[model samples]
Target: MLDARLKEQLRQHLDKISQPVELVATLDAGQKSRDLHALLQEIAELSERVTLRTDGDEARTPSFAIRRPGEETGVIFAGIPLGHEFTSLVLALLQVGGHPPRVSDAQAQRIRALDEDLHFETYYSLSCQNCPDVVQALNLMAVLNPRVRHVAIDGALFQEEVSAREVMSVPAVFLNGEPFDQGRMTLDQILARVDSASTARETERLNAMSAFDVLVVGGGPAGAAAAIYAARKGVRTGLAAERLGGQVLDTQGIENLISVSHTLGPKLAADLEAHVRQYDVDLMDLQRAVALVPAQDASGLHEVRFESGACLRSKSVILATGARWREMGVPGEREYRGHGVAYCPHCDGPLFKGKRVAVIGGGNSGVEAAIDLAGMAAQVTLVEFMNELRADAVLQEKLRALPNVQVIRHAQTTRVEGDGSRVTGLTYKDRDTDAVHTLSLDGIFVQIGLVPNTEWLQGGAVELSGRGEIVTNAHGMTTVPGVFAAGDVTTVPYKQIVIAMGEGARAALGAFDHLIRR
Candidate 1:
């Protein structure tokens, strides 16, 4: 039934197909004509392939099978693969073609032996540029191992899926149908979690009873400083963190920190960790602090339990848990984050150097980031929800002096717009004038504010301020004796690295005083 000319063209296209290459095409049941059938036969005669069969009569049933050319895998969809679903089909073919991107051999072995089928539902918005690395890393792993299957649902495209999963943010990944990890995770960490889950039968939960003299809860600049100061005081200090660096690791540079004129957050955290390690501090990486309770026997000692069920008793505690960036909480804001939007100027600014950028927020952090980025980026637009900037006069003067920095006060971000891959610009509405404007930029830095990391200590003995910061006396003494707090977690007027380090030293001294007196 096919025309001779069309059949010859199909034969030629099929003849050109080579080994180690797989072709996947999506065909609709209603659109399958005689010409298309002849083309399919030509493809079958030329190479091995798999065809996905969809019932033209029955709308619900869609099945896949290996056709004559079983080597080439063709994906036929009952529905269109347009929008977000197209990428999934391409990734599947890439996996079947033996072009599994980049998984280590050891990780691959562990992944292949995984007995249970894994369903990874990654809820993401194309707008979230920061999440692609996480998605790409997981997809690469899935490709390497057949047992792993990653299904990425565009949170914005599929409203039902988003509400079902309670997807609050982009880059949120779920493993084995359960919410496993949030934010972002590297490839190595993903592999570790998979291996842990796969070999979970052989592992037993470790019991608590391991104790230390001083326990540091976080591993950021403040936490690392506390560990170093405490260890130097000759106390058996222990430091625990889910990641080596706290939020600071996301920063690109630190110009305000005394002694360090310029330093990347990750590098600074690494060096500080090295210094802490040199002093005999017991460092536990990839551990989450779950709870803090008073020790049973000791009056001043407190027990710290980790998510891993490992616990440690400490005579004193320094709550150096830092802050996290507050999101705009707008629709599609999470999806576009990291793609064209970011939270850390120091970390992602350099990547957009000489390009246009928008800094959202009017406080010190926002003004500071705008000023800093103006030096690197071609043009910097500062959007503030408040009427005026809360930054100090000196910083205000400095920001005003920069010709490239444009401050738009009393403006709120409405939505972020991007090409489903990265950010192109953003939309803002003027609160006073009710005027809306869209500005084109390479990146948008959300410097709105920071939320203190003190939720874990709630109902504990430690006193917290109205703003949720832990309360400490001038000497870093908490309301509870023998318990001390420091860094951003405490009610410190200024949140600076040097100030936190000073407070850490003071807390360590105070702990020593308590121990000696006891």
Candidate 2:
């Protein structure tokens, strides 16, 4: 359930709700936990218009139905609400209770414009911070358009359905029972899947051009910076990205971006895209580099092929393909992604404010996440697999300075412990004692390592790290002369945004330098 402070906050928010809302949970009384009943009972007491009723069969044992004030039709939640999904529960109630719609006019316009009968089934874990955003967007769309039906399924609760769909991640959406999206996505992106016209336009654009002076792959901070710099030099620059904003889109708090004191993921992503668009960058949107054929033409331009069947020839290619978080791959870890199991603390840490959380790894990134989480979380536990902390002396000192943080070295994470809905705790083993220990908490932050996105370079001579990261020299030149690299995808030690941007600038200059020399 919620702490008193949070309970009060919910109560306050509920006070403003003008309509009645009912959450009918289909659960067996004998199998239900006492804490759950108590929690719902307390929530029911907070507002006169809010009520929780248990009237379900065996099959629907944890399903939730959100009934509006007077509407006969209600949205369904085929999962329990806990962990990061607690926010989703509150959001569902607020939306169904006829609280003034929080959607923007453009969002409403897009919802209204939906021509197809879209049924969005979002498979989510309780701890997934991104899942709620996707669910809330879909929920809003459902409220707007009768044709649009949105249902949130707990991947943990309905394992059979998840396995049937092969849902590997949270925030996974299925459009008309087909796999749609697998991760956190913008609203425009979700619409693009259902909108045929939008897809056709993208197809046309990709088929139109097949050549560029400088081609930048990946669209993270590094890729965006490279594209902008290359285009400013008045060269025919092109940018191909799976999505406009790279990993920065998943990151939440971004205070270290120099002048910007504070910013969120979505805002930074939009800004990066806008900045890139301001330049003459070709901006091949939503295209991914699948294959690279080196020394293709006599002109020395390499032929780069995309998954979308669009081929582009580039005299030089800057590989700015970023890195993805290294998952622990433990039981319940994959099931609880976006739920309690989180990789980017910057993106999902805020969702666990005042909640008990654990940070895996004792490296700089782990310590940094612990320090960051300590600012808001009630308790921060730092678990390091190694005997000693690998973070810098300064960061270790900073982490030790926080009274709310406790460091546990020589601890190997065993499994993430969670109820059917959300994470309640985690189990780890003491490397010295070989004894397992469980710590009750709300969230788990994994800051182990970053795996670079360089799998597509299978047939190329691009020198890469043993870990598959692209290896490059000071001039951002890869093993190949015309081919360059930068960002997290490269073997750069620091994966910070500022560092990536700087590397991007250097790579663009290096490409220009190569052109002048040639």
Candidate 3:
């Protein structure tokens, strides 16, 4: 199952197992089952503390459970967890074997103290980069709390279950057979969802925080750079964001970042967070800013309020809330977001394997998505509003070479059609002939562009552009005296990650200058 290099790495990782762990598999005579059996056998050979058995009674064939001998199983995998989930498999083994997880003591205690009998099942795809985080988080929770159990099912391998459950997205989590979440979620987010009182505890903690010298209102590349720069200047820095990694977390490949030839989005986001942590910055993840209140005088602190009613005061503020995926806004698109309409091609592409799908947009993202989907999807229709594709020449060439792909230029997506359960087709109109057409598809991927997350600042103190981006000066200072802006949320010409980081650094410096002048 595993190559020599992977087997050696697995052996080294499994060597850290401090307690005995058993792999009890229940598999049939199918090829997938045999493959899983061979994989399990190979895994059991990697470490002395690990053993394999075939006496389990799991209903799902080609599935296995990882647990201690004579103990109730807490972790299960319904398919071969290779690809992006290989790390998840390794972590599950280690955690179930009594090795400590890489979480804070309080987090670990919270997980262990959960008294509810929670059973989590996550339907994931092997190629999805976002699925591993959710899978690993649930797996860790299961390992920590005996009452909690998790089953990670590969949606592609279990098509009947995927179809029966109406799961068209990756990392779709169900709690005790009911829908819980539908996207990438961290351990803290999951805990908050399950533990209702966790939010109040967090709110109190946040409300008690002292005023900061520089407050960054986002956690993307821009916010991270600003926080790091401000903290390095020996100022009290605090960063609060809806999601720390922001849009970058949804990104797949990033080869254009300077000094780095190639890197993955999650890896780069982790590195950014780690770098910011090297400073004395207060990191507040998953906090969304609802309002920004500017100071009345030079001595007064600017206040930023969150959805939890927690307010944080700062001498200077940097707005870098970043952006989100631009939706099609057509009818039925919202109704079938998870059912069929997906924005992330890499995350949700596998669920539509051998099914017809459409890519809306003609930019690099759309072309790339079409190219990626052409390999798995039975038929891919690329719809473009422009007469010609705007993607790079190389990308356009590759997209045109795909046999199963059909390019539709000068077409506007008018509406998304679904059968209430899932997407069945789409409605579009030709710009030249004004003729309406429909496409039969199992999924639709919208990759037009991004919309700045500046709606919260609409009636705020800062000046905004026509497109809703915050207006900023050359020094990254906003219309407000002590407040600055940067990155995708601001009036920046480009929305690249490297440019965002540079703008964030500049905004941090500008805020520092304002503070010293005051």
RMSD of each: 12.3, 8.4, 0.8
Clashing pairs in 2: 126-339, 127-338, 127-339, 127-340, 128-338, 128-339
Candidate 2 whole-model C-alpha lDDT, 0 to 1 = 0.80
TM-score of 2: 0.66
Expressed as tens digits, the lDDT of each residue in 1-518 for candidate 1 is 43678456544543443324332332344443333344334444543542423223321122122212344222222222223333443444444545444456866776567676676766655433344446656666555555666655445444555445655455667777788776656565676676776323212322433567888888787788778888887888888777777776566557988877897565576688778878988776666777888655546568777776677778777767777887898865788764667776644554555789999888888898998888778999999888988888999999999999999988889999877666778999999999999999878888887778878888765889998888889878888777787777788888777787788778777877777776
Question: Deviation in angstroms for 188 in model 2?
Answer: 4.3
Sort the predicted structures by TM-score, highest score first: 3, 2, 1
Displacement of residue 154 (Cα, Å) in model 1 is 24
Candidate 1 TM-score over all chains jointly: 0.59
Question: Taking the tens digit of each residue's C-alpha lDDT, what string does model 2 give over 313-370?
Answer: 8889999989888888788888777567877665455556677999998887899899
TM-score of each: 0.59, 0.66, 0.99
Better of 1 and 3 by lDDT: 3
Error of 2 at 408 (Å): 2.2
User: Which has the greatest lDDT?
Assistant: 3
Quick one: best TM-score, which candidate?
A: 3
